[model samples]
Target chain A: MLHTVNKSPFERNSLDACLGLAKAGSAILLIEDGVVGAIKGTTIESKLTETMQSSKIYVLGPDLAARGLSEDKLVDGIQVVDYGGFVDLAAENTAVQSWL
Target chain B: MSEGTIKKFMYVNRKPPYGTVYALESLEVVLIGAAFDQDVSLAFIGDGVYQITKGQSTSDIGMKNFSPTYNALGDYDITKLYVEQESLTERGLSVDDLMDIVYEDEDDDWAEKPSIRVVSRAELADVIAGQDILLNF
Candidate 1:
């Protein structure tokens, strides 16, 4: 499994690089500005839903609500996680990728 | 620091919630870290401060702004959120103006909400050292 982390407003290079390597079963964590991706009706979300449909997406707790966003904001897919859970996600996935 | 016990991963959050794709992409990277089970932590500083702003409607951008997913973090377990005190003041903002997520309040409100810790650049280095991995987005 691939592990990904993002914390920017929305950098194409950040998501593209990670998504390119994703192989169906992967985890993506949203941090800081990265968690803002959890919001619905954003190009990033649609692209993720379209291309990275098979991957398991997660957003940092503080990052998500910090921006006043919830899991419901995302499409019908994409999973959300917290900081503690982020630690676990990093520990579980085999290969880790950090997209800036 | 044990053998494969603590896989520290530090992510840098430095951007606004809109006008760019860095923020969204960063989230995907963090989740990927969790899938790999790397103890992940994200530090927000600089322009990234606007990430926690409330009420985002990205419909105009022809996409869904998934900011609300931050609340679902409890599920994927990507916790560790830090903010630089300097950044807030430099950007002319306070914790109150930020989103309603867990934070270490500088004022110490001690509410049931999540705790957001405020720190300096030097302290940030200390936290970074504790991590086995660092990912700057």
Candidate 2:
């Protein structure tokens, strides 16, 4: 399954909930306010890195741009996906669960 | 407008009702967009599932209680509504908790067809992938 998290991990537990339920090999995409979690050296970075050991992690490139976060600031191993990439991820995964 | 172009438009609703304007705004956009003669579908993910729940009485909240407006979607030729099964499960809701919105199918002797499809996350993902445009709320 593909899990999309659109809430800030600091303000809401939606991202944590998504990370908990997302199974191994699932793809997780961070978009909108959730992009904040993609930053490196943050409290959630370790958790994201840990999850990366099993599943793929992606952040919407445009959302990062909108938030003035450069690709270099994202945690290592996390791929950046454009809107089209977002569509591709949805197509590649079996299912998608959005964490609001 | 292209002479004969009809795109697949999907409205992704992920917010709860009343708390914010996203749900209502998405619905209004869907209704307005229906006039374009395109294949339009709606997906209720996360708290979006709450927007279509039945027996929503906003009398005390001083809200419009626009849940009933979902029924009008069928009349507007907007019938495909995908409700994420996991979102509802986490929220302790079932299909029974949602309004029974239906539309008359012209191809099947006007048979009544249900608009809501309770879909697994994977199934909903497939639906999302097939869309030409995804409007998020």
Candidate 3:
């Protein structure tokens, strides 16, 4: 399953909930305000790093840029993808789970 | 728009109505998605259970009452509405407090069938596991 989280970790627990339920090898994409969780040194950074060990982590590049965050501010090992990549990821996964 | 393959699509609504437009916007997607003819289901969890509660009056809040839109979902052939039992209980709501959502079954002489299915959280999780796509809002 591909888990897509669009809420900020600071605002809601959607990312935490997704991380808890997502099986190993499942892909996680952060979009919209969810890009906040991908920023390095944020409160969720450590938890995200731990999650990355078991699941592939991605942050929407357009969303990050829209929030004035650069790829350099993202944690190591988290890939940045555009809308096309988002579509491709959804197609590649058997299911898309939107964590809200 | 793909043909010959029908994937299970589940829309997970976890937000309450009129908070930030997530609930209303999600409903619009569900309405439009009915044309795809895929197996679609709606799961109401957390605050989302409030979306279907009876006697919603947005007049005081000055927002258009979209709660009735859920009643129209049956007409669009989007009838599988799942309400998480725990969510309703936590909010002190019962099935009787929800709108009567029903659809006409063409296979059975167009008899009216209730569309809402109240299920435990565990059962809902099982339903989620079986889905091919989950749209969260």
Measured against the native two-chain assembly using Cα atoms, what DockQ does each of the candidate structures obtain, in the order listed? 0.09, 0.02, 0.02
Q: What share of the true interface contacts does candidate 3 keep?
A: 0.00
RMSD of each: 16.0, 15.8, 15.4
Task: Provide interface RMSD per model, one decimal.
Answer: 11.1, 14.5, 14.4
lDDT of candidate 1 over B1-137, digit per residue (tens): 22467677788888776546787788877776567665777788876766655665555334566677665553455556788877766544567656566533334463344635678988987997788777766
| Clash count, one per candidate | 87, 3, 0
Model 1 scores a TM of 0.51
B1-137 in candidate 3: lDDT tens per residue?
A: 76789999999987766646898999999999999999999999876775787666554335677887888887888889999988766544568767888888878898999999999999999999999999999
Q: Which numbered prediction scores highest in TM-score against the true structure?
A: 2
Candidate 2 lDDT over residue span B48-77, tens digit each: 776787766554335677888899898889
Task: Flag regions of model 1 displaced more than 4 Å.
Answer: A1-100, B1-3, B103-115
Top model by DockQ, which number? Answer: 1
Worst 10 residues of 2 chain B by lDDT: B54-63
lDDT of 2 by residue, A2-93 (tens): 89998767558998899899989999999866776787766677899899999999998765554335677689999999889999999988
Q: Pick the candidate with the highest lDDT.
A: 2
Extract clashing residue pairs from model 2.
Answer: A94-B122, A95-B121, A95-B122
Poorest 10 consecutive residues by lDDT, candidate 1 chain B? B103-112
TM-score of each: 0.51, 0.59, 0.58
The single-chain TM-score for chain B of candidate 3 is 0.96
